[model samples]
Target: MLHLHILSWILAIILFFAAYQNFSDRQGPSQYFKPLHMVLRVFLLLTLISGGVVFFQTMGGGMAAQYGIKFLLGLITIGLMEMTLAKKKKKKPSRTFFYLVIFFALLTIGMGIWLPMGPISAMFN
Candidate 1:
């Protein structure tokens, strides 16, 4: 479940950039943009679902607060990704949202790594 969540979010981030790049390079909507965006959304949903399952499975494990924080940050990062793409598509300034997405994504990923349920933890074990 943890690996699935991580993989989904990583794919989502990649797809976000790919879609954004495709959208930015063309005056009209690119053929790849919508497909990439749709796939991104799917991965984002998988991320949330997997994350939620992990969260519930690990409830009352004394690190719930930290997990909750990471979850919230992940949610914020997802929202910012959507906002950035929407604003870009409308020819609006999305630079701030783009930066926010980067910041929150990194923060969430860092927290996830630091948590004791992931690859780093497995490595030490």
Candidate 2:
């Protein structure tokens, strides 16, 4: 469980950096962006799975509801990120998709803070 928590934080950090790179115009289609995007996807998936495990192991009923919401939001954010990446080389990234990623990422981070001491606690509090 502790290992999972550590991995989640590490993965989140990596994903955040990758997202920043993508947003900063430092990455592109044929360059480092694609691989970074793939890594972010894998890391996000791992984070979600580890979080689910922690939630189920510790909180069973309504306590787990928060985790479910966070998980769904994470999935939506991942989808928006995927769409953004798919549109590489376009004149501009979709502002709607970009905003969705930012919103959901912040929401997930907030939930990580507000929730109990789980894998994400280290990230926010």
Candidate 3:
């Protein structure tokens, strides 16, 4: 379970990079962006599943509260990212979308830092 948790975190980081790259590649003529986007979506789903498993396994009152907040933020981020992609496809990228992405990213990272000692702290410390 611990291994699964760590793997999920690592994969989440990788998916983050992949999603960013996909966004950057949107301005290019590459035929790979669509597939990459799909891959990122799949990765994000897997990350969520694994993270949920970890969450349920180690859940407590305080941690549950934190997890709920993080989960909501994550869903919001994912929705914003999807909307950004949609707007990008229409060639109408919005500054607000980018700001939302950045905001959620920072919030997620902050939540990771503030999470109780477990996989995250063990790896960082």
lDDT of each: 0.88, 0.65, 0.66
* Cα distance off (Å), candidate 1, residue 111: 0.3
Tens digits of per-residue lDDT for model 3 on 1-125?
Answer: 64664565466556545655555435652466677677767766776776677667657656787777777776777677667666765667556886887789678767866777454677777
- Two-way TM-score contest, 2 vs 3, winner: 3
The digit string of per-residue lDDT tens for model 2 on 35-106 reads 777677777677767766766775655667787787677677667766765554463756676677778878
Ten contiguous residues minimizing lDDT sum, candidate 3: 21-30
Worst 10 residues of 1 by lDDT: 20-29
lDDT of 1 by residue, 1-125 (tens): 88888789889999998988887634856889899889999999999999999888778798999999988998999999999999888988888988899999999989988888867987997
Candidate 3 residues lying further than 4 Å off, grouped into runs, are 1-29, 118-120, 123-125
Error of 1 at 100 (Å): 0.7
TM-score of 2: 0.67
Candidates 2 and 3, the one with greater lDDT: 3
> What TM-score, to 2 decimals, does candidate 3 have?
0.72
Which runs in model 1 stand beyond 4 Å of their true positions? none
Of 1 and 3, the candidate ahead on TM-score is: 1
TM-score per prediction, in order, is 0.94, 0.67, 0.72
Most accurate candidate by TM-score: 1
Number of the top lDDT candidate: 1
